[model samples]
Target: MDTQQNTALTRALAEIPGPLPARGVIHIAIPHTDRFTVVGNHLAQHPDLSCTAVGIAVRIQSLPQGVEVGIKALAARCREGEKRIAAALRELEAFGYLQRVRDRLPSGRTITRTVFCNQPTALLRPRQTASPRRPAVAATHQAPGPAPGPGPAEELTAAPAPAPDPAPDPAPTPPSPSPSPSPSPEPDMPEPPPVPPPPSFVTPLPPLFVPLVPPPTAPKPPPPPLPRPAEPTPELDRAATALLSDLRHHAPQFTLSEADIRHLAPGVAAWLERAAHPDAIRRTLTTDLPHPLRRPALLLKHRLTALLPPPLPGVHDLAAPARPRVTVTPFQTCDGCDRVFRSPTPGHCRDCREHRAHRAHRGDDTRTAAA
Candidate 1:
């Protein structure tokens, strides 16, 4: 990573508070991977807490809770031995990088579980500098020089004072009013009539009521149609054919059974014809056979003899005497039936018999249903 990326990562890690130590030991341990080494080297170069490089790495990596690893594993990938690794780890511990927890394995091995040091360290700032103080100089005793300018009392008395104002005179006043008016004469235009007050009563009208009408009902939505079963696509059929063909080529045993070959008669016949014409089947089968089975062709020829119905009229048995019986010891027991059986058996004999019986029972049920 570049310097900027490293610096950013370091800053981010520093921002994450480390874990508090429990029982005086850090429990979080960061593996000594390349990432951890890079972080450690960066911490050594920066103004970071001394002991926290590994702890920060662990936290940044988001290691699982309670995960612990061996110091031997940590030191194995380092140039330094156990001592130096321990010292570096201790420095980190002291710096509050990780909280170490002591753990004992079932194998009687002791290990430390170091957790991320999430607890923050006290950050100290630089102190301010004090200003220098000036020393007070002593004045020489000056003689009572010729009387100084003014006396202190004279200076106070020289200030100005204020004046006072005069008073004014009063004046005179006046009188009051009388009582009722005398009657006057009436004019020829005389007595225009007085108007009457307007009427206060109003007529009450009957309320006109209209009946409420209900809104028209909306049509019900059609029920969602049932989902149709999916039909197989041509692509799917082609893909299945290709997959089966590949399986026949690579894992022929699965497809070479008599029942399977009968269902795939045409294909099997073509394949066998090709095999026989070019001798490819024989060569391939011989190469794939296990070492024990690959003896001289004569052994196969002898085995095939029993497969034939009978020998030609004049053809005599030109085979040598049979080899002595090889006593094969049984090594395994059938897990299903708990019966001891030979190693070369295809499967557990009793279990196989039971399985065959179960299959036959199922077949019988199927036949009955058909009937």
Candidate 2:
């Protein structure tokens, strides 16, 4: 490989993100025409060989053709005078550009492979088609060429053309008439007999009284008793106590009163003990407490009470507020009298305003005299 080209290729490969894998680097050096040409061209333009060195190193390790150089050999070749070849190799390996393949015998030497660390080039176009004219020429030469035919005009007149036939006219056709037939008398059939009506009853029947009976009553099912949760054990109480104590003692800026600690100690201790033995702690805290007290007790002891901090003094008891800050607005100072006024309007300060008015009055007197 051309050293400069190879170096440039290496630099280009390094510019590409990711380390070159050993197998991949060996594959790059496998003398594939397209890859070799692409890599060679890339190296020609940019010769920083860090990427190439990594790839070369990887290839040298894995492939039979590789020099089987240890880290020292690679460093001597690529990073001469550098502190450590192993360090450079490690950096390359981290980049995914170099990989160790095997160690050399007895010398504690390592072989590494360098591979191109790049995304595969997606070919945008397929190879061009072979020329058709060459194949045609070959075919014609192999078998003798066909005999030359007559010129265009002679070939056209060689066969006499047939005469054209006359066209027929299209017209709608009239409908054909049907044959007449004689009428005949139809035979009559007998009608069905009518149904007879029932005779009316003269005597009235006595009214019947039916007695009402009540439906059999079903026994109502007894209301299902409410489900009661299992009671919490002593271990849960101890674990809870220890956890709360730890929180109060170790947490920043937190203080618990003696009364509050005493009230909560049993539960906290139970909680800690249970935490040490998780299997013993009840799944639900409300399981042990009476139904009426369960919710209120949890709210007061666990959540609301634990979060309470020592009372702070009211805002009114603090020191009085400081005066609001004020910024001085810049104003123009009179050049003639040194009087400052809050106006940026040009020539309008007290001195300049009076000076301009006097000049105008003088000019008016001069005009009056001239008139």
* Residue-wise C-alpha lDDT for candidate 2, range 313-337, written one tens digit per residue: 4678686888999877568777667
Off by over 4 Å in 2: 1-98, 103-108, 111-116, 120-242, 253-371
Worst 10 residues of 2 by lDDT: 207-216
> How much does each candidate deviate from the true structure in C-alpha RMSD?
42.1, 47.6
Candidate 1 per-residue C-alpha lDDT over 135-214 given as tens digits, one digit per residue, 9 for 90 to 100: 44444444447877788898898776566456465355454455456654333343434444444344443322111221
TM-scores for every candidate against the unseen true structure = 0.17, 0.18
Name the Cα RMSD for model 1.
Answer: 42.1
- Error of model 2, residue 20, in angstroms: 38
For model 1, the stretches where C-alpha displacement exceeds 4 angstroms are: 1-67, 102-112, 122-371
Instruction: Quote the lDDT for 258 in model 1.
Output: 39
